[model samples]
Target: MTQAPDKLVQSPVVPHIVTELPGPKARAHLEFDKLWTSPSVPRAYPVVPVRGEGCTIEDIDGNLFLDFNAGIAVTSTGHCNPKVVAAIQDQAGKLIHYSADFYIPLYAEMCAELSRIAPMKEKCRAFLGNSGTEAVEGAIKLARFATKRQNIVAFLGAFHGRTYGSVSLTASKAKYHAGFGPLLPGIYHAPFGHVADLKWFDEVLFKHLVPADEVAAIIVEPIQGEGGYLVPEDGFLQGLRKICDDNGILLISDEVQAGAGRTGKMWSIQNWDVEPDIIATAKGIASGMPLGAFIARESLMTKWGPGAHGTTYGGNPLACAAAIETIKQLEGGLMANATARGNQLMTGLREIQKKHPGLVKDVRGIGLMIGVEFDSHEHAAAVEWASFQRGVLALEAGMTVVRISPPLVITEAEAATGLRLFGEAVAEVAAKG
Candidate 1:
C-alpha cells in the first residue's frame, strides 16, 4: 500500500487558523468572484481555498480547514492526488483534446476499466460525457432508443442533474423547475425510499397517467444526494427492479454523488445487491477532473448508431488518464479506508445525536456518504456555519440534513478531528435552540 504523505496521515494541530475566517486575502477573492461569477452559484461558507492536499484545504488567507465536503464529494482520491496529477500531466504532454468522433486509446481504456468494475452482471459498454448531467442525458436517450419507449419515472427528492433533460427528471427542489416550465414530456415522479410507493406506479401512475409499456426508464439515486443522503429502506431497490422488469422498463441508477468508492462499494447500488440496467456516474470518477459516463448493458448500448450521441470533450485524454489513476487509487485501499472511517464518523455522530436528541433527529448513511438530519433547516444551517467557523468544511442537503462526505483518503486522525469539530458545532447549535 502506498503511504499517504505525512501531513495528510498525521496532523497534531490542524485547522490552525492564524487569521479570522475569510481573512483579508480570502475576502478580496470572494469579492472579486461575486463581481464576475454567475449569481446562480451558492456559496456554502466563506472559504476561499487557494490550495488543497489530501483532506486539508488552505485558504488564500493561510487559514487551514479539514475538508469534510470534498467539493461536494467530487475529490475521491483527495485534492490534487500526486498519482492522479502525474497521470493528467503525462496525458497533457501527449494529447489534451481530441474529437470523440475519432477513436482515442485512453477512451477505450477508461471504458474497459469501467466495465471491469461495473455492478451489473451483463457485459457493459460506456458512453463518456463531460459531467453528470451529460451522463444522465445520454442514459435518457439510450433508454428510449433501446426500449422504444418515451416516458421515464423518477423518484421525488432525487437529484439527477440540472440540464434540460436531466433536470426534467429531477424533483429534489421545486425551484429547480419553477421558471423552466414546459419540461420534457412523459416524465413522472414517485415518492422515494418507500417500497409501498412503488405500487403507485402500477395502481395510479401507469393506470391513469403514462402507460407501463410506454415507460422507458425509472431513474433513481441509490442513496439520495442533494435530497439528503437518504438510504432506501430494505426491498425498495428490489421493488424498483421488479417493477421495471414487469413493465420492460430500464432502471438507471444515478450514482453521480454516491458512487466511485464514496459508499465503500464502487457503486452505491451494490449495497442493495440490485443491479440497474444503466449507471450514470461522474463526481468522483476522475478525482476532480471533469469527466462522467453512462455505462449500460452491452445489448442496450449496441442499439445506438455512431451518429446517435456524441461529445467533443467527453473522453479528453487528460480526464481519461486521471480517471484511470483515480480508479487505481480507489482499488488500492481507499475504498476500505472509507468503510473504516465512515464507521468512526457514524458512531461519533450517533453519540452527538443522543446528547442532543431534540435538535438532531436522525443519523444515517453508508461509508462516507453520510447525512445527519436535524429538527429543522435552521438548525442544520446553524451547525453548518458553526463547523465552518471551527475550520471544518461541511454542506447541507435536502431541507434539514447535513451531509458529511470527506475524501476517501482521509486518515484516521483527520476523521477523528472532523468528528470532534462537527460534534462541537452541533452542540453549539443545540445550546442555542
Candidate 2:
C-alpha cells in the first residue's frame, strides 16, 4: 500500500481571493474557449483552475477555492497527490503508451489487483478503457457476447455514458439524446431505486414489451451519479440481484461514480452485500488519469472470443502504474477517512438543512458521495453559484439536487470549512426567499 500522505491543510495561507470570481484571466480564457471549443459543454461557474493541490484549486485569476466537485469526483487521492504523481512520473519515464491488446506487466498486475478487491466471490477478469463511458460500452458488448442476447435493462435517471451504446442506456436527461437520434435498439429503461418498478417489469413489461430470455443484462449505478447522488434504500440492489439470477441475466454495477473507495467501502455495491456479475469502474480509479475498467466473473468474461473487444490506449502503463498507487492510498488511509469525513460532512449538512428548512429540503448519500436537494431547481442552482462565490466548489445534480463529492483524502477541517461555506450559500439562497 502507498504510504499515507501528510494530512492536508484546510486553511489557505495565501489569500484565497483578491479579485472578483473569474477575474480577467478567466474571462479572457472563456472568450478564447468560446471561439474554439464546442458550445455543448456546460459551465457551472467561470472559475478556470490552472493549478490544484489537495482539496484546494487556484484558478487562472488567482482565486482559490475548496474543490468539492473533485473534477466530477474523478480525483480520489486529491489533486496531484505526491504518491500518485510519483508513480505516474516513474512510469512515463519508462513507457508512455502500448496498445492494451499486447501484453504489459502492469496491465496484468492491475487486473489481478482488481480481482483481489472485487465484490464478487468468483474470480474476475477485466478490460481497461479511457473513461467511464468506454467502460460502459465495453460492458454492453461483453454482456451480449457472453449471454448471446440482445436486450439490456437500464434505470431511469441513470447516466451510464454519452457514447452510442452507453448513451442509449442513459436516461438522465433528454438533452443528452436530443440531437443524437435512433439510438441502439433493444434497450429498456425502468425507475431507479424503486423495487416495485422491477416487479412491474417482471410482470408487465417483461410479458408485453421484452422477453426475459432475450435480456442480456441489467446495468445500474449502485449510487446514481449525474442523475443525482441518490443512494438507494436497503435491499433495492439485492432485489435486482435476485431478479437477474431468476432470469439468467447478468447484473452490471456502474461503479464509475461510486466506487474506488468513495462510498466507505471498496465498492458501493459492497454496501448492499450483493455481488454483481459485472462491475464498471472509473472516475476515482487512477487519481485523475484517464482510466476506466469493467471487471466481470471469469466464468462470464472468458467466453468473449479473442480480439472481440480491444482498445489502443485503454491500459496505458502510466495509468496502470498510477492506479496501483491510487489503490494503495485508498486502502491505506483515504477509505477510512472518507467514511469519517463523509459522516462529518453529512451531519453538518443535515444541521444546515435544519437551519434552512425551506431551502434545503433533503440531505442524502453515503460516505463522501452526498447530495442536498432543494424544493426547486432554481434554489439548487442558486445555492451552487452562491457556494462558488463563498470560495467553495460544488456541482448540481438532476434538477433540484446539489452534489458534494470531495476527494477521498479530504480532512475533517476541510469538511467543516466546506460545509460552513455550503451553509452560508444555503443561507444566502434562503434569504432570497
Candidate 3:
C-alpha cells in the first residue's frame, strides 16, 4: 500500500462534492469556451475551480483537490494566503495601478528587496516586467546592449516563454514555433547539461554559428523547468561561467521558473556556487500576481538609458504589494520548510520508483520543482487523470514527465501524502497497460 501521511491543515472548511468533476455547470460554461475560443486552447481534465486556500482547490462541483501543481508553482504563499490576500486588498484600496514613468513606493521597496536577496547584491540592478517572457526579453536586450553582439545560445528541451524573443530561445516543442514564421535572427540552440554540450560551447560555438565575436550571450536555466526537471551535472554552472568569461559573453540564467525561493534557495543558480551576469525571475515572485524581472550587474545594466524599455503594468502598485508580502513570507522559516519538504518528497518518490520500476522511469528535481518521467507521454497523461480522480491535482511538463511542483509552504507530511497518491496513480496506469 502507498503511504498517505495526514499533512494538510484541516481547512476551516473541508471539501465537499455536489456533483462529479466538470459537472453540469462547468460543461455548460465550456460550451461557450469551445464556441468562442480555438479548439487547441487547453481544457484537459476540465474542472472549474471555485475556491482555493492553503494547498487545496475546490472545483465548482465542490470536490476538493490537493493542489500539487500550485498553478504551475505560482501561489508559493499557498492559494489565497491570508497575508497575500490582505496585502492585495490593502494595496487595492490605496492604489491599484501606476505609470512606470512615475515613481511608486512599492516599486522601490520591491526593487530593494529583490536586490537584497539576489546573488551579488552590490553588483546587481533590476528591471521589472509583467511576465516571464518580458523578463527574458529584457535580459536578451541587456545582453546585446552591453556586449554589442548578435547571437544568443539557448538549450535543447528548454522553455523560455511564448513571446517571440523568448520563444526563439525556447526549444522544447515544435508547436511553440508553429505558425510563428521567422523568429528573431542570429539565435542558436545548444544541448544543455551534458559535458559534450559544455565542450561544444567552448570549442564549436566560436568556430560555428555567429562566432564569439558576434555572440552576445548564453542563456540557460540552472534547473530546467518544463524540460523534465533536468539538473545540471556538477561543475556545469562554474564551467559555463568560465566559458562565458573567456568568450566575453554575458551569462543570463533564466531562473524564471526555478528562482524566487522555489529551489530551496533565493535562486537555483545559488546551489552551484556560480554567478550569472543576468538573472530573470517570475512565477512565484508575487505569490500569483503578474510579475517578472531581470537583475543585471551595475556595469552591464547601465548600457540602456531612459525609455529603453517600458511596460504599462510592469511594476504596478498592486502586484508590487503582493510581491512585498510574498518576499516577506519567503524569508525566515518558509524557505527552510521548502528545503526540508523537498528532501522528504525526493526520498519518498525514490522509494516509490524502486517499488514500481515499470511505472516511474526517473524522478528528478531540485527543491519543490520535481518531475517523474514515464515511458511515454500517453502513460504520463493517464497517470495525471488517475491522480485527479484520486483527489490530487497535478500537471505535465514536456512530453512524458509529470511535474510535481507544489506550494513551497507545503509541509513534509503534505508532500509525502501527495507523493503517495501519485505513486498509486502510476501503479494504476501500469496495471491497465
Q: How many angstroms is residue 44 displaced in model 3 relative to the true structure, after the best TM-score fit?
A: 3.9
Q: Which stretches of candidate 2 lie over 4 Å from their true place?
A: 1-15
Best candidate, lDDT:
1
Give the least accurate 10-residue stretch of model 1, judged by summed lDDT.
Answer: 1-10
The residue pairs that clash in candidate 3, if any, are 16-62
Clashing pairs in 1: none
The TM-score values for the models, in the order shown, are 0.97, 0.96, 0.94
**What residue runs in model 3 are displaced by over 4 Å at the alpha carbon?**
1-18, 38-40
Candidate 2: RMSD over Cα atoms? Answer: 4.0
Mark the 10 consecutive residues where model 3 has the least summed lDDT: 1-10
RMSD of each: 3.7, 4.0, 4.5
Off by over 4 Å in 1: 1-12
Q: Which has the higher TM-score value, candidate number 1 or candidate number 3?
A: 1
Ranking by lDDT: 1, 2, 3
